[model samples]
Target: MIRAEIVKLYKTVHTWIGVSCGLALFIAFYAGALTMFQEPIARWASPPAVGVEAVSLEDAPRLLELVAAAYPEAREEGITLHLRGHENEPARVTWVEDEPHEAGQPHGHVHWWATLKPDGSLMAKQEEPSDLAEFINDVHMRIGIPNPWGSYFMGVVSLLYGVTLIAGVIVLLPSLAKDFLELRIGKNLKRMWLDAHNVVGITALPFHLVIAVTATAWGFGVPLWSAQESVIFGGKQKIAMAHDLERWRAPPPTGEAGAMMPPSQLLQRLNAQVPDFEPKVMVFRNFGDKAAAAKFAGAERGYVGDTRFGGVILSAVTGTLIKDNRASRQDLDRRVGTVILALHTGEYGGITIIWAYFFLGFSGAWLFYSGNLLWIETRRKKARKEGEVEQSRSTRLLGSATVGICLGCVAGLSLTIVAAKWLHGRVADLDAWHAYIYYAVFLGSITWAFAWGAARSAVHLTWLCAAFTVAIPLTTLLAWAFPMLGMWAHGSAATVGVDIVAFIGALCFAWVATATAWRVKNGPADSVWSIRKAEGRTAARQSVAIAAE
Candidate 1:
């Protein structure tokens, strides 16, 4: 058993770490949970005009040739053929181009799509796909901080998060057994919050640890890899790194043009070699060249690896297997790395694990939120014992900031998602509008929270969050209800599932808003959480002035 003094030391460490990193972690967890359904969200936000029938596998070669002939630059940069052409990924062929950089700005890129018209003619359009899903993923990865610097900042936060986890576990070691299942929701608000936070944190400890390690690795992976090359590999760094990256390299195209085989034939050959292989994306390199190559990337069920180095590369011309990296055929090193990635992504366990991770992510968010609440409540109680009228200015300021940031994140994401349908064809640059809408709402929420007190802002913002979230499902339902309105159901199970889940989310937000408004009206007058306290103080001061007169 650990000694009492050691437990006290750990408690301090845990408290400080949790409080300091709580808000950022909250953003990460909340955004990360939504990312678990990244593909579904993408489909829901995409405009219907972008949807098109996927080119048949046998006809894919013709489409490829047409695209290459029409856009010569694609011959060099390559093209990606989507095997699963759902509404979200409606186009059969896609490619990217680097956006030209300005004198003072960094470089960027855009996506281009090629589709077959009903008349069997090739049509290509340049568009920036709805990046709402990727935006959320970015928020999760770096808490919405801009890249380079944001990644490094999150890396440090991730390392400290790991330490915080260890300290929390140690502090709870003594009463863990007795209170493992305890959730005392009663008059003592602090105890209730402590119990709730402990329950979620302890139960999801393993998940939290995995998240911390993986987040740290991703955030700092570049620097760590560079250091490893310079320090450990020494003079052989280039050779060592090249050897590792060799598995991913594709052969360059020969200058001579060559006829390409149909993709169906190539896919058939891949399946013959690896029966369990299911290809989702087929990438062609150096189209219409003698040395052209294609890689069919997909996943095998019941395996730890998803798609990375888990499929076969083939000769696009001869339909011969060039390299096999099938899940069952991987070397030990590749297998280990694939397993780590699979576990971190929860990609192995199918839909069940996806749902499990979804809840775990939200619970992780709740854990951080509850930690903040506990801090505020603890300070309030202390000030009361000291016979003070209010808590410290810092505490009040933190309360307002937390309310603003947290609610802003929630409402911003919801409102931006709603804009996907409302602004699709009406705007010239829909993708840019998504970003503008999100930032405006997010910044506006912060301003409101600071202008109004925490108690009032919390109630109003919670309702705003509910309304916007509800709009998501309502938009789809309205489309279904009125077919002439140019809105219609996507008809895919994925899109339907997204709508259903969003409706449920709306209800949850509404419930929280109701509860928060009640707390503002009826909760303890000594706390900043109760708006009644401020009103009562004002009324008392007015009466005292009248009596003195």
Candidate 2:
């Protein structure tokens, strides 16, 4: 009996925290799950362009010479050699040119791409690719808010989210074993929802905790770093920071003339030296100079944190190893930090881990979504006990907001992803159109939810989400069916997989829409989530009795 009171107290705390932060978590987790396949989504959005073949190891020397002769500044700023060519990447070499701003801060910069011509001359152009993947990533990181403020806001949400997790677990401890997998489906709608919510929340508790902690750390990293520098590091802060940065820096070039080794030779040398190193992108600093160095950044397979800048640096001229920073090369501090980041981002363990994270992310989204539904149902129970014909104004308002924000995120992300294909060449500024498409649909959903109330809007928005998600696959099929539209499949498995997953997602949304419509029309009439209104006081009590039965 004494333990029951403690559980009840925490339950109230859990409910408040979950209701307050559930919407944000829904947005973050849903978008974050999609972000697991960012590369595939990027390929799906990219239009056909002239593909630049990977520069041959032997021919890399000539390409380097041409770039050096054409852009002298590139010798200092560094140039990246593409290892794998795709529709989005049209150049063998790429670099950024900084654009100066009045405020003396880093502003917009131009991206330059270059390839070797048939006659051995360099062909270069300024390029802009669709930023669909990046936009989704931003939404996941900040829940569609802009910079520093967004980060701070998410940090606060994450902290609260952690507190809620603890409270929820404590409340569930007394009955966890008895109801861990229970999903009681009956006229008692609140009980059923609570069961589903508990299942997801508990099953994926570890994943949520990791995300909560890591998200807080990332969102507040700048402030935390500053505080540590000021308080802990103190006089040695600058020296320590410089030392940390130096480990990742490439050696500067010597001015003396020297012949650069072919890229193939460098690759072979790197493979021979590290044996476990797999080079993905090679960066050459101060090309053509005697002391020119190359940094090969790639993963050491089968290791956590392997993808985070784990490779060796070598002399571009002599093909000799200069610095080893492979996956296993990190010190204790960096290794732990990188592993935490990797776990949060799902950056390691290959394709299998990616799919696992993908599903877990969606599950997290569902947990918060069901949580909101439970809140509405709980309020409805209270109103019913009081013999009220309708749920309270606050309950109705929360229901509307919950449906609006959650479904808005779902439908908005789907439509924006669909826009990736439709708006590519049709718009003068495709990048801006991405934002326009998302916000228009998002705000439209929210406005609709508030205007029409939760019951009616829930059905409408679910159908809309189904339609938009279905459009993703239909767009691909239509592109193939009508070649005259100037869109064609890239014939890669990645793009094909995107269309397949989207089709499955559409089916899921359609099922949810059907289920929600049935519940709204036929479920408890006194509930804010129900569409059927009571004719009179007697009818309302009868309706409540019928629902309770």
lDDT of 2 by residue, 374-490 (tens): 998888888878876777888889899988988999899999999888877788877778878888888999999999999999999999999999999899999999988876666
TM-score of each: 0.93, 0.94
List where candidate 2 sits over 4 angstroms from the true fold: 54-58, 100-103, 534-549
- Computed on alpha carbons, the lDDT of every model, listed in order, comes to 0.84, 0.85
Cα error, candidate 1, residue 382 (Å): 1.6
